[model samples]
Target: MRLKLAFLMSAVLAAGCGWSGADATTESGGGTIEYWLWDSGQQPGYQKCADSFAKQNPGLNVHISQYGWDVYWSKLTAGFIADTAPDVFTDHLAKFAQFVDLGVLRPLDELAPTADINDGDYQEGLAELWKGQDGKRYGSPKDWDTIAMFYNPGALRAAGFSPDDLSDLSWNPRDGGTFEKMIAHLTVDKNGVRGDEPGFDKNNVSQYGLGSDGAGGGGWGQTQWSAFAGSAGWQVTDRNPWGTRFNLDQPAFQDTLTWYFGLARKGYMPSFAEIGGNNPVGPDKQIQSGLAAIALDGSWKISTFQNLTDTSGQKLKVGIAPTPIGPSGKRASMFNGLADSVTSLSKQPDNAAKWVKFMSGEECQNIIGESGIVFPARPSGTEKAIAFNKDKRQLDVTPFTDQVKDKTTFLFPVTTNAADITALLQPRMDAVYIGESPVSSLTTVNDQLNDLFKVAQ
Candidate 1:
């Protein structure tokens, strides 16, 4: 895992500028540390964290930047190559392994210990994910997430179903089971015909049964088809963390995706063409505008969907449901988490490490939890987040945690060559989703990926 990306890092990294250091200060031998993250929704909570960290360590300052997911990676890669990356930045499991292979991450082992951080401080197994094959740690756990189905209670009732009906929805690749039935029933045509009704036109849909945030969630599909596929007993890789082989070509996986994308064909889902304008409409907007009945999304989105309001500023009524049970006879959610990492290029590695440490601490994590933005890393923080959402915000978030409690959550696949893997898979998956290519074509793509992995760095 350490050197797997040696073959592709240069090509993937941008060709411009090098190590532009963060703004430095001479105050009592302290300096400013720049932190970058991709989620705008979590910015306010993290900003408070930054403020608190600075107050605790006088003379040191923290600067924060928020970028969209796509821009965040591109900018991080550019910074890495140009030597101008932020001092401390949020890291994803998918990308961190590649960063480890490229030797651009400062191992957290020694630094983590100094701050009294250990794997026990975070959700089970999250801290272990940042370790490379060489046993060097690169990330300190922050917050965790799992996928769930988000729905509009009003739409479900109008469709002649109640929120409880979603509690036990079952699915299968052959026919989509009760889950697809619910989606079809929830869909409404322009002329007021439901999708399950006769003469329900596939075209001219007034309300799609499902909404999406992207074309296909790239290769990971954490919020797209992951839950469905996983619950159907499809594993993304042979194992987690160090697995080199992908299961994209597996029959069950292919069949699952074929049915998932086929929903677009049935006009029950948002087609790429429908959401492909300059500004793509996300699930939240679709649900808020009464255009989509439900969407599969990450727990991180609880507040986003729950806080959604209409044009008149009235809060939209949204409900949460677990992933539908599948042929595996269980529900599944991709267990993903965010972490903070200090860059190998940082001008203030110590301060940056300290900031990363502080972010994972009880106070900072609790602040994040109380904000109702996300579930923080610590157990206490997770409890606080649940209470905040349930008691204060009037939202029960157990569906997200229930996956973990039931042991139906799978870890995000972690391996090197992540950027290359996505680069290879995204376009082909998009083609499949848009009906340009058969789902079976992924078999060849999987073979090609295996050849890349065979390099053994």
Candidate 2:
């Protein structure tokens, strides 16, 4: 057990941009640590953390910039090549592999206090995700998210079932499964039609049981493919980022893709063709408009959905559950997380490390937790964070909280090209779902990706 634990810790230590000697500079007051983050939702909470941090280190300046997720990564990559990256910035586990290879960010091990930070202080899976290709830790754990099944109570009632019946329903790719039945039952038509009806008229259907917003269709896996792909033991890349090989052509992967599209064909889900384009159809819209009974998404959307007020200002009674299991007998999720890493060219290494440690600490996490903005990356901190949300916000985030246990699975790739491949594949995936071509159309996507990996090799 100790050896396994040690290996896990080593993996965590391996993924990020390690601290550099360039990070060494004395804080003589008036040094600014530019911080870039994606969650505008957490700005209020994180601003509080910043204020507390500023109070603790009066000489340091924190410049926090918030960007939408898509823009943030693009900008960060540009900054890296230009040597203008932030002194300390937020990073995603999925994006870490790419940045680590660029050697633009600093590793956390050099900055972390040996006595305070060890393998056990974090959730091992999250730790592993933050490790870089050189076997060095690039980012320190901040928060983690898992996929959940969010459904509308009203929609379920209309479908002749309640949240309870669907709560524990199991799933597999085969037909006539419990999950399939609930999905079919939850689907309804504007003319009071259900998907199971013979003349269901899928073209004119009013509501669907599941939604896979065309955002993650063709070669893209994060939002759509990654979640379902995991249930079938499909990985975006082998364990090492530098050793990537596309697995999309593999049988396990093809099976998942076929099954996912099958849901669309059966009228149990919204056909990519039905959604009309690649634009995302937000979860709140699906539930509020009575267009979908259930949607697979993250807990981060919980508060947003709860706070959404319609034209009549009515709110839906929604509940969340873990992502369903597959033939492999495991509940899979696309684990996404963020971390704080130092810049290799920072003017003040010591101060930067201090900032990184402070932000990644339980105190900061406790603050983020109370706001119900995100779960802390540390295991102990996460529990307290969830409990805090329950007591302070009167929101039960336990469904997302409990799913982070051994039951959860994450998509980890072996190469920095993972992000590049994902970007190229999304549009093609969108093509597949929109009926632009068949599933085999994605064959070129995998082929090109395999070629990219070979070049990197």
Candidate 3:
């Protein structure tokens, strides 16, 4: 889920206090190179990698710093504007195209020969996503992710549905199928009336059956509605990576969205307005607060949900399930991954490339896998991640990993004009989610989105 990260600002103020970057000395071969990332949860793991690298290469320091997602991107954009960006930082499939266009990221192939890296060392189709239309590698593969449904076991039992019932849940745009029925049964209002029960008031709803990390998932629903759209067999572009045309207005996609957003009106899901503005309550918090019984979320939040604490700080047990079956007769998830790119602004390009290579290597990636926060791109590291989470953390990440093995995962749309795509679609999609605009309005936006690719040509 490329656009599907949880917007938890719990570390915002602390993370944004200062930016530990842009100070790499213009020395020959040995100097400190700054690295930055958005996820505070993954900082410790990367910090250890930085320490290992620094220890291996004396006099060449790697300063790893983290910031909130909003501030991370803002600071990154501002740094790019000022030509003072970090030497090496985490990169996403959605944003790298823009950086490649701006010529701010140094191509890995152009780096010093001493910093040797191999594409074959990573997972299939991962390192390939970091390549531009110019056919130059801009990033080294780090980790990958997918989407799944996480629910409160207590809530599922209360609704008279066993954990096994979720396995065969079927969905369609027409009547929502058994998935909708389960959502209805799980939803309860102020009077403790289930959504399926008579006299249930949607207005006085206290608990929703479904929740997401965000409202409008931009052009890619990801955690919001992507599981349904993807399972319904909808794709964002005609062809990814370098697509010239888009399928944002396809009937299959339109129908999927229509039913997806309709859940809010039925009080089975929270409306965009009900959730906190700008800083929304993520599915993890929703489960913790008793506002939602089930939530479709990305695999990146595996650690948080698997080890959750209630508002009163008591342990809350949560289980995950694969996305329900759709008209496509299969489950689906957006396959996404992250990488680290050395900035063109770096004075220590060789050292920066070395750092990036090391991070992508088995040693560093294995260290990251052991953190149990994400699945690394390297198969060896990925296996380590699966084992550590299941054995140590007691996390059942099979549903997430199964999507990859079962071939039920689709790539996150990788193309240029990603920011522009989100700008044009967010407000309109938010309107659709809130019932302020018809889903048909996106047909027009979709046309406009296609125009962006046309204009590029």
Candidate 4:
């Protein structure tokens, strides 16, 4: 999910043309700081914090900007190249190494002491994720996410299974274990036949057992197949935070990919033609329309899924489940965190740092947590977020938070050439998903990826 880029160049061009427009400035204090984020859902919460921040600091002002995920990254990249990047912006782990290498990010270590920002105040390992290979901090932790299964309880019951039956589902590469069995039982055809039945029609299926956002796994499957691959004892790289060797060609990874894609061939999952064709559907829509029984997604989508309504305007009751245990005798998830980074070319670095510090502070995090949008990076804020979801949204988020408390999550792959690596391997991965190529085809792509890694070094 991190590696997927769906930017529209036309929109980027339009934004670039208006870079010098009035939308770029708003006076506060004695100067203004430009801040950018991609998530529109979190805008209101941060806007409230920004207004409060400006009130307290009479001499400084912060102008917040929101954009779609793809447009946000594209504009940020164009701004960096033009030496007109935002004063401060939210950063992702997938792009962290590249931004650090480009020297577009200011080291937060120097600003932390002056701003009274303590790295220890944040969640464990989160602050560390923002540190560069040179041992300098580039960003401040904002929030974190983990992968989990989202299912409709009514659909499960229709399939003759209860919500309790979903607990502790196990998987394997060879036969898919109990996980595949569950999926097959849940899949139904237009003629009222289940996938597990002998007369079921693969082509005329009315509902899929499982659904994905797109064709499924990409270079980094944070919300896709990473759970399976990680639990099978596979790692994207030999080490993280600066690993040189990639292990996508390993047998464990290949075996997992084979089994994952086989679901498409068996009609338990959407086929590539259905997923990638015109009028393509996403996991959320599929579940809301009763075309899919289950979907694997990130914790950040909890609010969106909970608020979805079907054709008759009935609120869809979504349930959460942890990933199934794999061959390694455990379940796994990608532990990824997002942070805010100041630009190296900012005209007001001091003001920018102040804003970043405040945004990442406990006060603003508490506001964000109370919004029930995501799990804030601060432990206290995280507690408030869990409580908000339970009390207000009535959703159980333990399936996601439990991975962190249980220490069953792995860090997302962190490498300097992540973009290039994703660019090179994505097509091959697409082929695997479409059944045009076998999982072993990744060996050739792996070699290409290692070459790119060498060049990055």
The C-alpha lDDT values of all candidates are 0.86, 0.71, 0.86, 0.85
Model 4 lDDT, residue 452, Cα: 84
Tens digits of per-residue lDDT, candidate 3, 194-282, equal: 99999999999998998855655563888888889889888888887788777867899989888988888889988887787557888
Q: Which stretches of candidate 2 lie over 4 Å from their true place?
A: 1-29, 81-84, 112-116, 215-220, 240-243, 273-276, 392-394
Candidate 4 lDDT score at position 245: 81
Score every model by TM-score.
0.91, 0.86, 0.92, 0.92
* lDDT, candidate 1, 1-457, per-residue tens: 6476864676446333454445342121347888899999899999999899889999887889899997999989988886778888999998998888888998887664334568888888888887887887888899999999899888888888889999999999898899999999999999999998999998899999988665553648888899988998988889888887889889889889889998999989988778773256877888998889999888988988988997789888799999999999999999989899988887767888888888989999999999988889898999999999999878889999999878999999987788778888888877887789999999999997887788756
Query: How close to the true structure is residue 342 of candidate 3, measured as C-alpha lDDT?
Result: 89
lDDT of 2 by residue, 396-431 (tens): 666676666666666445455756776787787766
Worst 10 residues of 2 by lDDT: 20-29
- Which pairs clash in the backbone of model 1? 17-82, 18-82, 19-82, 19-83
Count residue pairs with overlapping backbones in model 2. Answer: 29
lDDT of 4 by residue, 363-448 (tens): 99999999989899998999999999899988889999999998889988888876787678777777888788988988988888
Question: Cα RMSD (Å) per model?
Answer: 8.7, 12.9, 9.5, 8.1
